[model samples]
Target chain A: MSPLFTSAHEGTLAVSAGIGLLLLAASGWVSVLHRRKPGPGTRELVLRLRAWWVICALFLGAVLAGGRVGVLLFAFISYLAFKEYVSLIPFRRVDRRALFWAYLAIPVQYAFIWTGWYGMFTIFIPVYMFLIVPMRMVSLQETKGFLATVGMIHWGLMITVFCLGHAAWLFVQPLSGFPVAGAGGVVLFLVGLTEANDIAQFLWGKSLGRRKLLPGVSPGKTWAGLCGGVLTTAVLAGLLAPLLTPLPVRVAVPIGAGIGLFGFMGDVTLSALKRDLGVKDCGGILPGHGGILDRIDSLMFTAPLFLHFLRFYYA
Target chain B: MKALGQILRSLLFLAVAKPFVALVLGVDLRGRERLPKKGPALLVANHNSHLDTLVLMTLFSVRQLPGLRPVAAGDYFLRNRLLRWFSLRLVGVIPITRNHAVSGGHPLTPCLEALDRGEMLILFPEGSRGEPEARAPFKRGVAHLAKSRQEVRVVPVCLGGTGLALPRGEALFVPRVCRLVIGEAFTWTGDTTGFMSELEDRFAALEAEIAPPPFPSHPNMT
Candidate 1:
């Protein structure tokens, strides 16, 4: 149950130390490259790096703060993500009230996680909000794009609130028999690998990308990047799982591979959404990273997958 | 004491209102650096949502807010006793009666007096909230207001997505990115027709700099 600063369990602190060292190396590399000569993306790369520093530090602080704080953080993340979602898409003006109700579902979903009510947490948005969204839209009495509006509201909640809420709910799951990193360790593992996988894929594609993975969907994604990201993530999982979670190296490696695959699925799916909307980024919340949705798009898929993965096998 | 009271009231209004506006809509305000540093200026934007006034008000700081006045429809905002008090005291809105024929006084008097007092006036030149994210005909009021004060700096702001966020009739706010593109300030000429056409040109240019509204284009254009 050692998740740095929470209880000073050596494993979590060690992971934090590794992350700190990685940050140091990255900044140092960026500086050295700058010293060589000012380049095109160097400034943007530095901004992205600085943002990553803040995001990583805050994420570590929140998750380590405890289950309640983790739930609150994820809830806030869901809030921002959902806000960006509705902002990016267009809907009939009559559905504004119903959309507000959709936003309200975020806190309710997180409340279930805060109280450790998994049963309600799992079904609340998918089941309850599904019905409520349509009914509320019908009450607006606007038949024009009626079903479409309902579908947008429900789907927005599912992706932004429902899926991301799983990461928070994972924090509250009891770490009983294995004395694993408790829930905190699992969150760190899942998020850490997912983010690492994203970076690996991006860097790999940047350096050695040849064949476009999905030319129409995401031109930047390459098969080389995909294989490289999976391999890199698999290794990271094998190393991290032993320290953070109760999963053995043998099991964690394959899970890491799955994360890479599902993480890509989430990324490309949101990319498709952006394409449909004809937007480059959802919003400019983050400086170089685009929006909150742009950053957490992969986490949307990975969070739910990892949560159900644990529920199915371990928990 | 009155000056102090004004500041205190603004603080109270901001404490409650600012965060709620910020929470619902992420305003990507561009060219804010061009905001007039002092008063006797006009902030003219296209009218879209009720939230447009609130969103514009939040742009100015506490110090700048006191000298600022929103030119609103008296009939709309002053519909009730509570709204009258709040709009007068807290919002500092200069409610101009839409139909001067019925009201029997110069509709531009309040705006002209505000400018003469060296106060900044926030005017929606389209007169009222039109179709969401669509530009309506530029009402001659703002042009006439500017024509009264020759030295007034007319800053054109195009608010995209405000109509989508709250619009005219909606009570609940849908979280949307409100793009506020502020153009460089210009002075008004004496001729009302020429000034109105120029204002339209400025707004058109500012609108082009922002993201096109996701909704279909309205059949009517300014």
Candidate 2:
């Protein structure tokens, strides 16, 4: 499996180059329209966006460094994300033994992905781990609210482990035909483009955003932010296309926008769960930030969807 | 391993009790700094809502006050599996039989032992919770403990507005503002019987100091 860039696919390269510039222009436009005049918060958002841009570039550099290094980064992301998820929803003493099993799944899931054993990785949490976890809980014979207890554990694992496992799958894909260096680059591309949408929407919403989107579910979400984020994401995806897959410029733009839109839905869904639970900030470990669950809520929804798309288009 | 077990036990208690407590319950703690910073301290608090224990945990969760154990009788907390586990392991509860004969005489050994170990023990002293703002007859347990461990700092704490949250035999915990007043610690000095009487008197004074003025409609509005 050679790097996607090894193919020197000019079509993909042109798509990435074109989309990047357009996305920048769209983001600028959204900033101008919403803020009308930028305030301190708006200025901070811009700084955050710039920081993300540098991070993406650094990650891209690592992917270009080598395949093994790229895979390591994917594994690291899964580790951090899963750590954050577990910290938010800690287990009771009776259920804590199952925690070991849950932790054991992380390495196994990534290992399966490294070996390209897609079938095993997909079923690891929902199937095998599901059976084992409940049995472990029942063996104690505590027998109080058993169903609700087990269900929460299973659900938490599904989002944190199953969804996150997809990131590792990016490495096993054969990216020899792509314009970028490796399947790892495609993973980086998808993550960067998706996260960029989050930043864009947040920035736009804080500025010129007036109309609320799904006010009951997520009071802060706004239509203006959604429009701006989608535009920006699609354009960025198109520009970055040359560094990853051989998708046409037209395809990259729309696909990025679609991912961004869906990603927003994912964020809101997680937010709804927290709101229903009547919790503010999932665990409050991060000084300014909330919890691990809060940070990765978007990825929980987007990872599986993006992976399915990858398999559909390139498999 | 034993020390680690004690801490893990506390965390387990917090984890289980967390759900029972609604996030809506708000606390406006007054005189928190008055919490004794040193040894052999007795936190004598008025009981109103059952959730008072959790509120206390939240208050002291961040700070380290050695030998800080809440005395819970076997009748209420130990009757169930979950609460028993929580009370024994996490709360460091000391079971005291209510109005039962002490076969060996001197039932205050547990209290004295705790103080000797340089730990803080919380006592209800009224033996059970009372109506909000209404004072109950103080049990001789606090007086007995003070008489045995003369060095023990007797800190009286009054909790207000808890019964409104989960009054007797209620499952639903309604959110309400709860208040806590920590009275200054005082020493007990006198003959055996007189010392116990003095202890009761000091307790009454602390109660009066913390208890709010009776409403105009109060039947016994003295």
Candidate 3:
């Protein structure tokens, strides 16, 4: 249990090289795959690819720099995505009072994780945020769906703050003996794998996703695409385990499967929220991407569940 | 103390109306401090729907900021006895004659007097409600008031998405999300006549200049 890695075992440099190769491979594969799909216009395609490029850059940066900086980057992404969600929902003057609590939750929840207070991070949203939000609403005495309005705020916080905050908790995990399970590596694996699954699912879904997973909420999502995405992530998890976690190939597969399934569920849940709110995206902040909520919907569900599993097994 | 009470009353109305309004039309507002706390402040807003005034009032009221007395039309607010009474007292409506002198009551005088009393006035300088496709040309009233009261700062507001909920010549109040954008206050300058004319031109040109970007985090200058 050394405090740092030996010179030969350092995965930072190789991780960068691997990422470059992965990007080149992905672009090549996507080009050949979609060559005849009647894709978006050249300008639109460039813009869409640029967003994926930024996400990849963030991924590569996280793997290179572990610990607090890694966790902070993930937290920052969550906060921006959540802001995008709230902006889209049209809140009434009475509902405006809840915003103070909603905005306040972003920093406090992350602070709990930053201090290595995992217990507080877990319940901050469900318990503290839940109580404080309703109380804030009560002060406004806004009789509207006092319950429902408070519930949506809670739910939004849960998804945006609590669930997304899980990625930050990776900093607190003890990664002394792990191979692919170092704090930095795990964050990279979880984020990269989950986002990769998203990209894979979309590609697979677009190409051969004939059967709808849930036609009412999201017509594009399909069972075949889901299976394809999970399978891809599982294989990637096995290959990247030594660099990311000490769990080895055997454990990484199951974990990757969990991320893929839950990430898909997160996407569905967010879709449901949009359905109820009658909005397409949370806000038009992201081009090629609908909104912040759209981008992090998968992370919201995957991050928290991943943290819990890691904590139960390793921490 | 009076302003405080006015804000409390406005909040109370919003608190009561939240359920009915939120159930049907969603409402969201930010950057409320843009409304002046003490002194004469002009709330110039884009007139898209008939509900713009109500939504703006609800917002200013809930902030517990000073109550806004909107400058409405002589023809609309002063049409019938019941409406005139309700508009004047309940909503604090000050009727302005259509490009002409007031028939009986004071037109700009009430607004000017309100300013002197350190009250806030919501001025819709379009003269009347506009069609959805285009915002009607702004009148010179906002410029005149700003120039006459050099000490006052005029706030520009671009309201989006209220017309779909409530259209012109419609009696019912429909439900929809409305945005009240509060830009920073700017003082009226230059020669009085020219300043007023330039102000009107600038005010009308704002919608095109702003486009559809996210609301500014710190939009208010003063």
TM-score of chain B of each: 0.90, 0.78, 0.76
lDDT tens readout by residue for model 2, A210-229? 99999999899999999998
Instruction: Report the first chain's TM-score for all candidates.
Output: 0.94, 0.76, 0.87
Local accuracy of candidate 1 as per-residue lDDT tens digits, A53-74? 9888888877566556777788
* Regions of model 3 farther than 4 Å from truth: A1-9, A21-40, A179-181, B1-138, B141-222
Lowest summed-lDDT stretch of 10 residues in model 3 chain B? B213-222
> Against the hidden true structure, what lDDT does model 3 obtain?
0.69
Q: Could you give candidate 2's per-residue lDDT for residues B95-149 as a string of tens digits?
A: 6656467436566677788889888788877677666445577776777787777
Report the C-alpha displacement of residue B80, candidate 2, in angstroms: 39
**DockQ winner:** 1
Off by over 4 Å in 2: A1-62, A283-287, B1-222
lDDT tens digits, residues B30-52, model 1?
A: 78799888899999988889888
What TM-score against the true fold does each predicted structure earn? 0.88, 0.51, 0.60
Question: lDDT for each of the candidates?
Answer: 0.83, 0.65, 0.69
Interface RMSD of each: 5.3, 17.3, 14.2
Q: On a 0 to 100 scale, what is the lDDT of residue B17 in model 2? A: 47
